[model samples]
Target chain A: MVRIQDLPRKNFLMPGNAACPGCPETMGLRYVGMALGENAVLVIPASCSSVIQGIYPRSGIGMPILNIVFAAAAAAASGLKAALEIRGLKDAQVVAWAGDGGTGDIGFQALSGAAERNEDIIYICVDNEAYMNTGIQRSSLTPYGAWTTTTWTGKKEHKKDVPLTLIAHRVPYVATASVGFPTDFIDKLRKASKIRGFKYIHLHAPCPVGWRFDPAKTAEVAKLAVQTGLWILYEYENGKFRISPLSRPYRDKSKRKPLVEYIRLQGRFRHLKKSDIAVLEKYVDEMWEFYTKLEEIYK
Target chain B: MEEDHLVLPLSRPAPGAMGKTGTWRNYKPVIDQGKCIKCLLCWLYCPEATIIRHEDNSVSVDYEYCKGCGICANECPVKAIEMVPEVQGGA
Candidate 1:
């Protein structure tokens, strides 16, 4: 197993890509590519990456990309890997890179099926929390009390607990990472790349445009997301679950920054009332408490 | 490479050049190394990959293609970067 620090220094995402400024998906994709090495095929669905990868007859992704439908990334990747194995190539890797809308909503069926079947694929769900590609429509992953074009007053429903849902299948791997934590993010991707059966990494990417935040604060926002316990960073491997070392400090509860500190930085929650924020805060605390219990049990 | 491919913009990494998006900027980000804690967040989040990381791990921006999006400045955890108005000179 290649050490996380020893991952190759090569740049596979290239420089001229069309991603928006301070795009977290671009950051996640770059690190994932670096850790995954170059001998991999990326199966992307219809999301922001589709546009960022460039217009037809011109592409920016250094490696090959198979752009599947809105809900077929994992299934296509499964088929691709089966075909590769049939051709006597088992060492190659197949990656399904999809946005939260694709993974948690539209493509959840295929992804669930792929994971249940133990397909040898790396499925990365870059969660920016909304359908950013389709003009910032709210998706199941959009956090509660966040304003999208469709949810002008903020979403009334809670964000889907996608990682736990994935873990339910007892897949060989399930992890939560954030663009703000590159080392942990890449480490999980590298570790997932080496494992067999199904692997999934729910990377919390920040969408500046959709979230109505300065394009430059994507990393900062993502960082605060984890520090405030609003986003949990943990991994599930071989029936064991543990919080990531990067987020271990927040286990003290006192070390966690306030949830308000994280939400106020972005404009999406501008319309949210204090009561709504309290609800969100309670939800965050509940999730963190759940993680703490898991950490204790795993330890 | 058939036209019926499922991937969007059915194309592999195309050759040739991309547009010179540098000219689109009205301001540019300037990194102050003294204030820099070497967090590397700016480098990691740079959409254009213009944040060049030296072998020594110090980072510098590639102004040749930067669009003055100020992303690096916004993401720098140490607040070591500043966005400055660009004075264009066509001469």
Candidate 2:
């Protein structure tokens, strides 16, 4: 339970940037900056961050950022880490920050290779659930029954479990965090910094414009996702898996809020009918069941 | 050989890189000092990093850079902040 006053005062994600009002990317990046401080270099791919970083001639973010291509963020970070080591700058952390489209789809190969080789770089996948940078196109991580520009009738496939995929790589650390819980995210970033090898933090950032929700409800919507048991916050470190303290109470089915409370808030889930809600709820239950089994095995 | 040298356009790090995004907002958040608890939750969640958390634990909104997202007002547990229209002359 880190206090607000206890957090670092340095603002790495400076104001007057290109980020939209109530953008979750900015919120998450704020925590990342507070945790890592001045000793970090971000590897950003072709995503909203590339634009939010502001156009050439002036940059918004305080940290050094290496803007790479769509599918080369993780690979670039790995090489950057090697370069830093050779230059006697081992303390400088190289972070690969990418969107779901770049991480789950295009950059998955590079990310997996780095994870397999156990590269010492922090790879953060800011999952906004779709290709939000280039309008709302459905991506591999987009949940089922969610409306997107490409999926007008709602996506037919379920959201890809990227964290679990990373965990299978037996990485040193893998955590799921949300923009709603800034303290939890900040704590996780600090923890990841201490560990060596591939550290993957899947940050759930709800996009207001793409999700068709009120800009102010960004935090509210993210909170509902976790409260409804739709998005589980947990960490996998060195083969030991456990739910985060914030989400521990939600393990009990009775304690969890109804899935509709989370879904109805977003216009993207408006197309979901009663039957669709039921399916989504069942999917949530299955996900919980998987987590419970995982805890039993590893905890 | 001198003509073959590659010269690239570069952007320097600076605050207000987008140039006073405060102009983009239609509504701005106004904090009621009496109701404020000095919780600094608004400061924690501000996307623009425009909310200044002073040394005394008091929080103030820097309207010059704040895009007026209403997130500060929305997330305020004490309901100390309110969103007001920027242009008072408009209906």
Candidate 3:
């Protein structure tokens, strides 16, 4: 286990930020910031992060943050990176931090362009599973049967395979991390900072207000997500697939926690029916099987 | 390679049982006695009934099943209950 005392003492974020009581995105930023330090340029879109950082002259981030439109984060980060290189500043790492709505939905075109071209920048999607900044609305990345403002009854579609979609571009690196596992997240950021091509980190951030969960249970929900196999952590390095070790045995239907355990904590999924949970469980099982197969075939 | 496959364990503990600590929602509640007026608001609001009533009528929060919603603190008329940050509780 990674100890907080052994980590660097430099603090990149200040208190009094605008994030809700248990915003997991802040933890994600804390880990990434520790890994990259002051030599990093962050590009954020108009999302929860933008609000969290507050207006200019009162921003929470100690490092430089460039605020841009929702759909232009990736493209803008690429431009900033190239500009830095042209100015003979190749040491600084350029990073794009965006929300699920920005990366998985609106900014996908720009992200695809940058990844296809193998731009030298890190693009992180801090996914709370929906367009939370605007409202608790459904986005392309919202999981199946999840409740959202847009999906009042519950989402009918499965979350888009965002990591796989990026891997299709054959980028140098792509991985998934969560604030619940800070050491893993920090390690991924350190690795991404050293890599020289397009890199993507899909971070699972829990939004307490948006999810209607108790502020204190955010990390618990994040851990449940991975333990339930509803959110698997994997990375594709140069077309090679590597999954995090199964922290425990596979959770088959008979042994799995009731889907309601994962759903009831968040008010968003309060409207889901028993049949909806069953459908979601089936999908989770199928996805888990598919991922295990990938590991076996690739090995 | 075939022999190596045999080295792997045949089965492991159930996923939910392996950690035993259910989801990350496990939290302990704290009460600020200095701010408390012995109003018993926390005792009445505790969903798990984990609050203990002392002979003096003072309330003590139990950590075993407390979800730590801070509702008790918010609802406390005397501002006595406070949500103490657990080491690994929040996101």
Candidate 4:
């Protein structure tokens, strides 16, 4: 029950950076700063965030951030945490923030190793679903039937279930959050901060430029992602699974919005034919079914 | 190896690090003070962190660095913020 007014007024992200006008990465980073405060060190890999922090000799963000190569964010974070402990800075938190390309594809091995070892770090994968900074290349997290520069028609493979993969490792905490629901995201961040061991938060951020939507519609697009069942918000902690309140209503099949409503808003899915949309709809159902089974088994 | 003598390639944190991004905006957001409920939703959603939340809980836009993305106007629950086109060269 985090209220809007109760949020900290201290902004970690400064006024002007290199992000686009209505970039979703910045939208999420604002809350990330609010929730984590000044004690965290962010390790960013090659992604939009790397550029968003601005050029050398001056950083756009207020806190300490280590910009690393494409496949080393988690590895760097693990080392950073160990170094902080050696310096007797036990209270400091090390956060690894990377895009989908870095998390699901490029840096998956490092991330997996860190998770398996139960590293004391918070790994946040801001999944915008593609290599957007590199001009819209496809990543494993890219949803099926969405067009990228490489996938001229549409991506044939469904999105990778990275959260489920993390769950298999039985980490201390794992949650899926959306930029549309900032308070829910904030609550998740706070909860993760309090917990020890590996924590992974998958933040669904819709890209206005790469996703081909109006800049002003960033929040709306994110909200639609949840309402349509394209993205489910939930948290898994200490061998327990529960759906977040914002998305609980959509668990009822009748309450969920049509998948087409979510797809029609983005130009990347404009080329999706009726048959392709049916495939997407089926995919969403399968995902929901898998989650429901997990809940039942865990319960 | 004294810390002071260690020449590290460090970048200090600075505001407007990418220059005054307000210049990139084609549209400027105008807040209608009367309609503002002081919810600070605009400040929360702003990507550039240009919206200023005051001590009294009232809000104002820092035009110097605001990119005028219209997100404030769009996310305004009461339509308190309006996006006005920037008139260049005294129109």
- Which candidate has the top score in lDDT? 2
Count of clashing pairs, candidate 2: 1
lDDT tens readout by residue for model 4, A86-137: 9999989899999999999999999999999999999999999999999999
Off by over 4 Å in 3: A1-3, A246-248, A251-258, B1-91
lDDT of 1 by residue, A1-299 (tens): 23433545566776666776667777777787777776678999999988887656767677788888998999999999999899998778899999999999999999999999999999999999999988999999998988999998889999998989988998999999998878788778878889999999999988889988877678888999999988889999998998887788887778999988888888999877889988997897788788788767755
Least accurate 10 contiguous residues by lDDT in model 1 chain A = A1-10
- TM-score of each candidate? 0.90, 0.97, 0.76, 0.97
| Residue-pair clashes per candidate | 2, 1, 1, 0
Chain B in candidate 3 has what TM-score? 0.62
User: Model 4 Cα displacement at A270 (Å)?
Assistant: 1.0
Give lDDT per model, in order. 0.83, 0.92, 0.73, 0.91
Off by over 4 Å in 4: B1-7, B88-91
DockQ ranking, high to low? 4, 2, 1, 3
Q: What docking grade does candidate 1 earn?
A: acceptable
Residue A285, candidate 4: Cα error in Å is 1.4
* Local accuracy of candidate 3 as per-residue lDDT tens digits, A37-105: 888789998888887665444566666778899899999999999999999999989999999989989
Better of 1 and 2 by DockQ: 2
lDDT string, candidate 1, B1-91, tens digits:
5856665545667421255556666778898989987666677667677787777567898776676678788767788999988875621
How close is chain B to the truth by TM-score, in each candidate?
A: 0.74, 0.83, 0.62, 0.86
Best by DockQ: 4
Using DockQ as the measure, name the better of candidate 3 and candidate 4. Answer: 4
Which 10 residues in a row give candidate 2 chain A its minimum summed lDDT? A53-62
* Residue B81's lDDT in candidate 2: 96
